[model samples]
Target: MANTVSAKKMTRKIAKRTAVNRSRRSRMRTFIRKVEEAIASGNPNEAVAALRAAEPEIMRAAQKGIVHKNTASRKVSRLAQRVKALVA
Candidate 1:
């Protein structure tokens, strides 16, 4: 459908970027899921550790524009609160 050479090149670039973004999104989700699983299991220590690992990944995704900063902050904040409550 892309007749122009430039259009073809752009299509190729889009495909590559889409693959990368998809992987990044999937990776971010996996980290978040780990934290949720830990929390659900009701193990404070494991949840803390998972949150530690997930926070950076969530922030990174936000930085990359995969997710909004507020969303990432909210997620981190809520998870941290739960982890803290577990400790108390």
Candidate 2:
């Protein structure tokens, strides 16, 4: 129940922002899932390619505050290590 005009406007803005953030987060997850699927398939080259595609998106999500920086870094680190282990 937004009582004031300003509060109603703020609610509308929040709804719009929420939709945008949700889409961004979903896109990021899709990228991460692609990497995971590639890894699970045991194709190192495919995994590498997926990781290459996903890294920037993950970082972008972090930059946009969708995820924490360390969370992003840790995910990238772990995924990279898995890809490396697959390669080696």
Candidate 3:
């Protein structure tokens, strides 16, 4: 469909970027899932540790444009709250 050489080149670049973004997104979700699993297990210490590990990953995802900045912050905030509640 891309008739121009430049357009074809852009398509290829976009595909490559898409794969990279998908990988980063998957990695970020895995981190979030780990935190959720820790929370579900009801171990306050483990949950806190998982959150600590995930917060940076989430922020990094935001930095990389995989997720919105506010969304990342809100997610971290909610996870922290849950961890605190579990601790209490």
RMSD of 2: 0.5
Candidate 2, position 72, lDDT: 97
Model 1 per-residue lDDT tens digits across residues 1-88: 8999999999999999999989989999999899889988999999999999999999999999889999999988998998888878
Clashing pairs for predicted structure model 2, backbone only: none
lDDT on C-alpha atoms for all candidate structures: 0.92, 0.97, 0.95
The best-first sequence of candidates by TM-score reads 2, 3, 1
Worst 10 residues of 1 by lDDT: 79-88
TM-score of each: 0.93, 0.98, 0.97
Colliding pairs, model 1:
none
Which model scores highest in TM-score? Answer: 2
Choose the strongest candidate by lDDT. Answer: 2
Model 1 bad stretches (over 4 Å): none
Itemize residue pairs with steric clashes in candidate 3. Answer: none
